[model samples]
Target: MIRVQARTEQSRLMTFASPLLAIVLTLIFGSILFTALGKDPLQALHVLLIMPLSDAYNVSEMLVKMGPLLLCAVGLSLCYRANLWNIGAEGQLLAGALGGSAVALAFGDSESMWVLPVTLLGGIASGMAWSAIPTYLKLKFNSNLILTTIMLNYIALYLLIWAVHGPLRDPMGFGFPESALFSDAALLPVLSDSGRVHLGVVFAVLAALVAWFILSKSHLGFKIRVYGADEPAATYAGFNANGISWFVMLFAGALAGLAGVAEVAGPIGQLTPNVSPGYGYSAIIVAYLGRLHPAGAIVSAVFLAILYMGGDLAQIEMGIPIAVVGMFQGVLLFFLLACDFFIRYRLVSSRETVA
Candidate 1:
């Protein structure tokens, strides 16, 4: 028999090594998976990982994908640091998109410079309002935030679908479940001529930098760290738990909302029934893989964005299932958890245990 034992002290090196180890394990798993699927594992790996960055266009697309992942992950990093498990970034994102689209639609053909900014503001407010509901439930009624946020994700999705099919549907488009294309005045500026990269990328980077500053340097960050580390200590120090929760959740909602609106106003240019390929869900993995650091999340976001483009490339080149991308993300998360577990504990053999 084997016994699990906690180490007296965690290894500092493991903090950084765990994600790398997890990636190695994920790659090994992917190799086996590809072999079992009757595909060449090496070729599949190349297609899934290397090819996405082989061209300028794909690189630009990866950055486009990175914007939302980074934005969502940065916000999530803050919430996790505060010991709040907010799981409704996806819903908040959808709410933002819906809200922004509504504002954009109201603009019709107006060329006012305020169109874009107002639309983005609408989206941010929408996202904040969406997140506020669950935050309120958790604070006032002591409800399970995890459950409430998860449920809201579905609610938001369905609500967006309803809006697209009902009120927001484009009348000139033969009944498609989508809003009308946003006018140029309401859209994000393109960053490059070669790809769909847009101003959203700048917003994501700025958000990450701001978040890093907040987490590492600010008084609020200290309060958040203290609150997460020891609630009793925080209470003794007169830190308001409810206030911190509200702040982090609202901030997260705003960033996620920005991401949602950016998508429609940038690459998509319209409110579609499918506005995201699950960027919000994927950001959870990026957040953890980055050790819950905003800066680290940027790196992880870049890696995940590669996988996003690679998933499309694999489907087109190797006839691989698009679901493989989701599988890879799930596998990576599992491995990361396993690696983290090992980093904090050790296994004792039967003889060692007996001794």
Candidate 2:
């Protein structure tokens, strides 16, 4: 018989190696999936992985996608480090977009430089406000946050749908479910003259830096680590768990909301029913794949961004289903979890004596 036993001490080496192993496994499984779909695996792999890095324009687009993922993932890392499960980043993002859009629409005629800053603030506030619901419930009623957050995501989506179709609908869009284009002052400045990359990329990098600082150097960060490691120990140390929850949830919501505003004001240029293609959800995978570390999440976000670009490339150039991208993400996460499990436990042979 084979038995699984917990390690006496966790493997520090595996902590770094697991993500790489997960990537390799994901690639192997992805190749098999391509072959099963009746495609040349090597060619498909080239399209999905290699081709995205072949050109400058593609690289820029990948960076553009990376911005939101990085922001959301870094925020989520903070929450996870504090043992706070915040699953409604998607809803918070939508709420932020709506709030920012409302500002843009109201100040559509403004030429002031402050418009942009104010819009971003509106987004952050809205996101924090949305996340506050779950936090409040958990604090006041001892409700489960996971269920509330997930349910809030659907509610936010529906609200976005309604907004685009009714109140925020563009009059000149031929009846499309979209808002008007933001004013020039409301839009984010492009990073380069040729590419769609915007200032949001810089924001994402700054966010990662801030997250690293907080997690590594701050007293509050020390408390969060202690709280996550052992709740009772944290309580005995006189740490306020509820305060930590509020801080993390609100902070995470702010970052996610900023990502939402960036999408509308940078790339999309307007609010729409399809403001996001599951960036918030994908960021969850990014956070874990990066070991819930801020710096690691930056790299993971870039990798996931490549997958997103590759998905579109495969669809257009190789006739592969776009769903394959999502499949790859799911497979990568599955492998990551498996790797983590093995890192914490080992399989050993059990000797049985005849009874």
Candidate 3:
């Protein structure tokens, strides 16, 4: 007979090894998927993985996607670490973009250097404001944060749609649901004239460093870890649970908001109905894949960014469906979860000598 049993102690080595195993499993499953679809598995894999890193321009584009993913994932990591489920980051991101767009539209012709800073601040503030809704509900009514946050995403999306279609619509855009192009001074500075990469990449790296410091070397981080590990112990230790909840939610919202503004200022340069291709949602996966560590998130963000670029490349070159990207993400998450389970439990075999 074979059975599974819990480990006497957590496997320290497997804690780090699980992610690698998950990657290997994901690749195997992906190849099987390609074969099942009647496609050339090797060629499909090449287009989905290798083609995106084959040249300078592709690399630059991949980095462009990486910036937002890294920023949002780092923020999500903080919230996850504290056991705060702020799943409405997508909503917070939209709120940030909306706030920044309001500023950009107001300063349509200004060449002031301060416009960019003010716009970023506006985004950050708006994100926090949006997050406050769920925070308040959780505190006052003891509401379920997961449902509130997830539902808030739709509210934010519709609010964005309404803003672009009604108040912020560009007159010259022929009824399109988009705002006017932002002034040059309001846009993020470009890193290279030949490519789309921008200064936001610098911000992403800095945010990761800051996150590492906060989570690893700060008193607040210690409290957060304690809270996550044992709520009753945290309460006994005099750590405020409500304070941690509020702080993490706001902090996560701020970073997500910054990511939203960076997307518009760095790449799109305008307020549109679609400011994100689900970066906020995808960041959740990046956060978990990185094991909720700041440095890990940076690396995972790059990997996820490559997946984004590769998905597009595959669709264009191999004629694969765009939905494959989501499938790949789901597969990766599933495998990671399975690996985590194995890390905590082991299969054992036992037999009777003469049953």
Model 1 lDDT per residue over 42-150, tens place: 9999998899889888888999999999988998999999889998889999999999999999999999999999999999999999999999999999999999999
Predictions in order: lDDT: 0.93, 0.90, 0.89
Lowest summed-lDDT stretch of 10 residues in model 1?
7-16
Model 2 TM-score (2 dp): 0.95
- Candidate 3 global lDDT: 0.89
Descending-lDDT candidate ranking: 1, 2, 3
Task: Select the stronger candidate by TM-score from 2 and 3.
Answer: 3
* Candidate 2 per-residue lDDT over residues 1-355, each given as its tens digit: 8788788988888888999999999999988888898999999888888887888888888889999999889989999998888888889988888888888878877999999999988888988998999999998999998999999989988998998898888888899999989999999999876669999899999999998898899998888889998999999999999988998899889999999888898899899888888888999999999899999999999999999999999999989989888888999999999999878887776762222
Per-residue lDDT value at 163 in model 3 = 91
1-355 per-residue lDDT for model 3 (tens digits): 7878789998877878888899889989989999999989899888877888898888889989998888889888998898888788888889989988988788888999999999888888988888899999998999998999999999999999999998889989999999999999999998875669999888988999998998999999999888988889999999989999898888888888888888878889999999988888899999999999999999899989999999999989989998898888988999999999977887776553224
lDDT of predicted model 1 = 0.93
- Candidate 2 wrongly placed segments (more than 4 Å): 1-5, 347-355
- The candidate with the higher lDDT, 2 or 3, is 2
The residue ranges of model 1 lying beyond 4 angstroms of the native Cα positions read 1-5, 346-355
Check candidate 2 and list the clashing pairs. none
